[model samples]
Target chain A: MATTLTREQQRQNTPDRPKPGGRPGAVGGHRNWLAGVAGWLWLVVVVVPIYWIVITSFKEQSSYYITNPFAPPAEPTLGNYGMVIEAGFIGYFVNSLIVTLGAVIPAVLVAFMASYAIVRSRTGWFLRSVNSLFLMGLAIPLQATIIPVYLIIIRLHLYDSLLGMILPSIAFAIPLSVLVLSNFIRDVPKELFESMRMDGATEWATLWRLAFPLTRPAVVTVAIYNALTIWNGFLLPLILTQSPEKRTLPLALWAFQGQYSVNVPAILASVVLTTLPILVLYAIGRRQLLSGLTAGFGK
Target chain B: MSPTATPTTARGSRNGGLAWLAVPALVFFVAFGVVPLVGVLALSFTTWDGIGDINVTGLTSWQAVLSDPGLPHALWVTFLVMALSWAVQTPASLLLGVFLANSQRYRAVLAVVYFVPLLLSSAAIAITYKALLDPNFGLGAGLGIDLLVQDWLGVPELAFGVVIFVVSWQFIPFHSLIYQAGVRQIPKSMYEAAELDGAGRVRQFFSITLPQLKYTVITSSTLMVVGSLTFFDLIFVLTEGGPGDTTRVLALDMYKRGFQANLMGPASVIAVILVLVGLVLALILRRLGGRDATHSQMEGA
Candidate 1:
């Protein structure tokens, strides 16, 4: 199918004959220049706010209001960071870390196993239905399920706890994780599985020794992707947890917004702190993150 | 070869055993995903406060939701946001994606720069924008832009616009990334052929790039629409649907109905509507995009 599309593209893009004096260089130069200008403009649009957040985080409250917002702080201070840390930022950070780890690890593990089953057992009615069920989940927005989730969490007596957030997050992460992982798993050759089986390896051993190692890159991708989502999740924490001490970083940022009121520097300092961990993660695994996210679309 | 034949038969029997590997994930999905979804649908028909005994009030909440003045206004706001996102974000991202895909230098660095907003949490983005859009002490004011000196989040007329702009700003990078991937797939020979045919860049874009991106555009549009429908966190932090509910969306209304108003029935109704709208829109987009894209591939798989 893809080959046909590419062929069609080639045919349509090519004219019946070449034109004289095409001036290809002139056109190419103009387009490249245009691209460069747009790229730089976009860089400014994206970078300035991040820059503003970082610089503003360091400025003293009085200095923030007195100086130009874009200018570097003449008198930088860690006072805002100090204030954020004192306001239980460390607790929020821990809560976020706990939730992300708790949710992402189990979600990816279960998803990997399930995807392996789905890919290998493609002919079973039960497995086909299961695959459809997971795909259907892609359409089930969390907004639609929050009310019932709230009730379920309450019934389980897990409300106002990190587990409340962790459980639903795992469920929500499963569909995409399964989709991406199964796509990766299917690309593995059938010969490997058959050979492993012929060697008297049980399915359990095959999964561990064969599929698991083969799909490690995909495992990492799903892990990082799900971790990013769970780490940044706000709605689950907001609706599920009530205690300030249980707040995650996103919720903590919201709390800071209100508590600081007009203390913009303090609020932004929390923003910078809240975003820093994820930024570092992104910097490290950006290629994997991008590939994992766009993997579903590309296929 | 003889050993392989015997084990192949053994593997057939072990298939059911291996199916048990999916049990843990299925249990989680059934507990948190399937149960709540079914419960929400059932709860939508009943008039029950969170703690009280359940009483079935058939269509009462749905009627209330349909008749509520606030509901229509909220839907309107959500639709406006969706339209703005489609109109502004889609084209901008496509252009940027095309530019980035074509560039040979600084491609990786530029792509990362554009993706910064997406990597950050929505709450952080909202807070950053909230401070940045402050009329007096913001970057706009700092840059001496008199027009941006107004209270962006406070003015009723401009609040939703600012919310949409910020939302688009955060998401454009995401859509652009998708477009960039799509653009990268088109063979370079196609572009070279176009250039050989005396087709200029603009002509090549219209003829080759746009046509090839049809599926991607549909995919991104569907995502943007569904996302805009349920959007809450950023708007919640930035404006709280305020300056008089100008930015209020259905998700926020649903949140308020359940949490603040203690009207679980109406909230469930709204929740059902949001899901239905999302599903219907996704289906429609799939149909419109020619059904040959990822959806079919997923099903075929």
Candidate 2:
């Protein structure tokens, strides 16, 4: 093909045209073939741990102990999942769901208003101070606050309750949510706000009718980020909740390991069960995540 | 509705305007965020066993910590873990990001693999690793790598290394994603020009790619430092500052002194220090990143 193309090119007057194909093409083709294999190899590395957990969840106790740890179970069992659910995973899941929603809803609402006021209210000491105070949160690691947080929870008698878990989660989540939302709100068209104002809408009404709707993507992104953070949270739940009934999924999974120490199958089973809600949430919100990443980082 | 307002009326509205919107958040934050923080700061100056009554014991915990044999080593370990993780992960993710960015076919797959760890709960991952690293029945034996597997939670030096590795593992994906996003933004024209000049892949990366990714490098490094310094959950679950307090970080130390040992004052001191560290790091990052206004604008989240 290259020889034929060279002869054809020799006969032609086109200067930029070159020989079409040869051994060099095969080398490039081989590189692509190698790249394809390498790509699949990378995917396998990513998928393996997840696959391991899922498969382990289905294995029996005997399979976990004395068999090839890397091999698939010859006979998968539902017993581990059965035990996890029977152990009241449903209660923990419900506790996590309610608390996360309870905290995130109000937190997002408050942040939405606060961000609006800061962005819309022209420059002022009060707004500056509020923004600074919130930004200070970026400095205050939750680790530093853990001891004090524990004390406060204990004093409020929130130690073993879901409310204890919900409040601080909201507080910690608020600053970043406010940061992201405010930046997004600042980017909203000034024309819309002016139009709303001309139509006799109050500041409150304009905020709701215009800013809220315009900032939906940012709002959704913040919500999903907070959801994952709250759902996967272990420290708050671990420190605050003593009873199994009030525990979140991570805490419950932790507790499962504590009680069933060597029961590898049960432990893996619980891990699978525990990660399900987060996985479901992530899968559903995967589109939002991509948009959020692109919007936040793509400039 | 009017944009025009007299100064007096605007001031009046401003005074009342913030009232309705600000009160709830003010109350919430004051009660939950501010009070606890201040209370803990105050606690740091006092001696309280967390029970009957509060008493200001004035720097006794601080003195105890300063004089204690364990404090320096713990701090050292914490510092080591944070530094080592940043050192190891930054390059690894950068290389991984470069590879993923250059190879279109493997981009999606490698990215998912790198990021899969981020999706798992740290506690779950820590526990799984704990089991996997177990000396006797775990994969440590089968792989003939048992000696390499420390009783991660039980050993001193290894405990810190294990925690750092675990935390870094979780973050590499996140950092890679950031790098990938930045790398993808480089206009094809630049690469094409470099190729026209007969620049090799390595040269193009060094001359064009790295320079273009300055903002990403800064952002990711700052995030890594801030994250590593504040890290708690994985360390807490995995090591619990075990094997004679060798793995205790500032955060873990604070927790133990304030909550476990009932020395609220010292714990608060540690908390205050942690806050200062965060503030200092953020300040440094802002200064470093400040020169590039476009950088922060690009890093919207």
Candidate 3:
């Protein structure tokens, strides 16, 4: 314990030390032709379906039936996309956007604050218990608590509303968010925090100015990860909300697929649309998201 | 997360004042998380139709759930999915993780392409697979391939198999990502030392790499197994426990009983079971990983 901190402290003090790069790549790499074959085969297995979804989504309804499923559309058309959007897809997208942004921002904020407390006041009994409680929370799969959550939301008169989904989403996201954020905050050199204290900064001020800035990448990573989870969430929306007006994208996609069972292109179009936003976000934050994908469970 | 985060001995205020910073999150979790946890247990003991007045019922829901043969089947199916998916994913992910841990540039591109599945929702994935497997207009018919045109989600065994396959399709990439990180963390010198000892590639892997990945295997397996417990969205959309309840896992069982059938009490009981099973499995997997990994992960998490 002491060794890691001192070593990290030394790394911080020594400007010449290039920050530890991503763990050194595995050695004896090409010798494993077997993993390579599996990798490429797995890649094909993955990409083929995704490829089918995109290309078939662009095909005309009849062409979708006639063309090779693996081939690109013969006469590409936006008709499926048009059909999807006009059928209340925009409203579902907006509801999803609202639910995701509403839940993720506050979830990450409060989680960040809690993580700051956990890391900054490590030995404090209350903070330690709080930290451990969040850890224990991870084991209590949020799905199991759905029935109670449904009842509670009804009692609170939040049921069937976006707020209903947002509240539980934030709660469910807390444990992992705190896990990832605290790990990142713990890495901010204590010497910097000590200096921040010497500068007469309140813990709150230091949290925002020092700890938060230093750990911004972790914050972004946590936010993006939570956003993806909440955005793609199905159960909470399915169980919590009732009205079609309130359905999030994932729930709407299911319902749309059910309604358009025969309209494969339209259904695939909805699938494509449901995934596009996160794919864009993934493109933007791929490195941080990949590095922190396990939510610090790996660490 | 380090378990070893010592208290910052910043003089003058090594105090508990920062505790309030944690209070907001605690309050939310307690109300929504901890309270609901207690609430689920309490609800299990009550009779509520999910709408009408709640009446206290002693052991009635338990008695009903215990007597129902469907409960055992549901539990068995849930266990099957967890075990099957774990067995399928672990080795595949471990190998792929080791494969991607390489510095090869094309492998990085492969990693990017492989991750596309992880971004899509379970509902979307299920929908895509549903359409792709449609007998009349799906890829099977389009490509004129009779073998690809099977009623994948129709028959009991095939539906069960499709559920497992779809779960793997959506999740294996994410697990592979974790393994990649795990493999990368392995010290290169371990392999170098094994090479000096006249170890071949396969020998080095068995002697060094596999052993070093013990913690990673446990972590990934724990996540995979535990996460599979609540896999409601995918299975619900794909098969809806179809072809006569072959794919009806516990999460769906709870949902159907509570929300669909208006039997909230029995559903709450199922929810409690799910929670218990999850905690037990997590603990068992941690134990399998040994004390150091357990102390580091459970205590440190």
Candidate 4:
């Protein structure tokens, strides 16, 4: 905590304003009513749909059309959620969890090690090139490679399998993971590594003990970010996995929406159910998640 | 600070064992990422309906994709979405960022709420919009707001407009959060100096805020532009490239051709184009911002 505070103070001292010290400060906006209006107006735009979806998810389909869309259900029923679960959303939910965890765990572990190597052995030209390759991976729209990925999956006899999705997802998650992890890993003090080394610890041991513990927050942030992404991923499952039994939540949500085109509540319930885990996660980790996000991107 | 610095540490850290640690990530990336990157280019020249044996016929796929009017239309739609969404999101997010940067208790609450859309999957958000914008049984008909009731994803111009609006609705919060961080990062002393110079709040925003956020703008815009190219799931779930293919962006075009129609070669052509456009745009944005590798890695958004 003391070190972090000092580091933060150090960060504050070295302002990254493009114009040496020319940062806009005094934004005391008591009369900035236009922006205030815009902010609240955007709030309505964001909240109204969510509000409608929640209320609609609880309403019976028989009364859904006759009632107001924005109004709370006069006679709420749990039938929509019940129908959704009965329609196998729980299975889809489980598939999504497997894919998310399946991809994220290995991606973070492998990425953490790569980050440690890049930061530790910065002098190695080959390692530097590898880091460069990952950085270049960032600029590529890795999604565009889905066609060839599909081809590879088919050839590997892994089509229609959750593992197929997991492989490519891990590959795509790496570049950013390495960048963020390396950024955090670089912040670990050199003295700490030297002390561990002097104690006769191997690089691997020092890595797990010193680097991993110190960068645990970054590791979590990377995991959550990748998990959210993989959980919400649709295209991979859409093309790679063909069987109903293999559908992840996003693909299942799309398929479920198509199946229940007439029953809006049931579809809405599936959306809610699929997102509930993430929303619950957000509620619990809102502070850590948001700050990690802002810091990960903003830094 | 020690004058000797890190000669020992730097040399000591250059162990060969440390270099091998990057192997697993490198191997995975090469097999999946680097290989596919090259594979897309190679596949573009071949004619194979995704299930059949591989056969290469150079330049045929390119010729077909280039000659087709659909390609240009898709490109134009893509260009429109990228430009329009950037224009809309950049200003609103910048202003909203400045607004949210204030450390009021209410603002904290607002940030939490604003982030809700970011949590929801694009498929869910698109599905929600689809139901809400259903001309007959939607929010409009339910509320009797005739103005709100329209075939939002059916009509051509309106469909295009809906695409941009939905894109903005889902993404502006995220970009706004980035800008908010950018705003907070501004040194307070600069604002004090500007105040001492008698600059009003609006004037200070124009001068200090605008100029200092140059890099942040590039970072956000790069993500916005490059990210817009791959907006397949949102557009697919919402409109499936729409009533007349009016919303068929490149990503959707690639998917439809490759998976739906079994035309992998043509789709690979589109994929190659996407990679080029992404690279070119990223480089242009990077060049525009001069140079800062770390700041631009904010492209993860």
CA RMSD, predictions in order: 6.4, 6.8, 6.6, 6.4
TM-score of each: 0.91, 0.87, 0.93, 0.93
lDDT score for residue A25 of model 1: 16
Model 3 C-alpha lDDT per residue in residues A1-299, reported as the tens digit of each score = 44653453343232332325644444442246678788988988998898888988999898777677888887899999999999898999999999999999999999999999888765788888888888899877789999888989999999899999999999999998898888788888999998877776677778889999998877887887888889889999998988999999999999999899999999999999878888887788787776555555554
User: Which parts of model 2 are misplaced by more than 4 Å?
Assistant: A1-45, A290-299, B1-19, B102-106, B142-153, B291-301
Q: For residues A1-299, what per-residue lDDT tens digits would candidate 2 score against the true structure? A: 45643453243222222323321111111112233454455466557667777777788887676666678888999999999999999998899899889888988899888888788876566776777777666556765777777788888888899999898888888777777788889999898877876776777777788999999978887787777778888888877777778888888888888898787778888888887776675566654754444336433
Chain B alone, TM-score of each model?
A: 0.90, 0.85, 0.92, 0.93
Q: Rank the candidates by lDDT, best first.
A: 4, 3, 1, 2
The number of the candidate with the highest DockQ is: 3
Query: In candidate 3, residue A76 scores what lDDT?
Result: 90
lDDT of 3 by residue, B55-128 (tens): 99989999999899999999999999999998888888888987877655567678888888888899999999
lDDT of 2 by residue, B39-91 (tens): 76787778777676878888787787788866677678767877899997887
Selected candidate, larger DockQ, 1 vs 3: 3
**Residue B254 C-alpha lDDT in model 1:** 90
Please state the error at residue A91 of candidate 2 in Å: 0.8
Error of 3 at A281 (Å): 1.9
Q: After superposition, which runs of candidate 4 have C-alpha atoms over 4 Å from their true positions?
A: A1-31, A292-295, B1-14, B292-294, B298-301
Instruction: State the lDDT of candidate 1 residue by residue for A75-130, as single tens digits.
Output: 88999999999999999999999999999999999998899889988666666787
Q: Quote model 1's TM-score.
A: 0.91
Give the lDDT of residue A79 in candidate 2.
Answer: 94
Comparing 1 and 3 on lDDT, the stronger one: 3
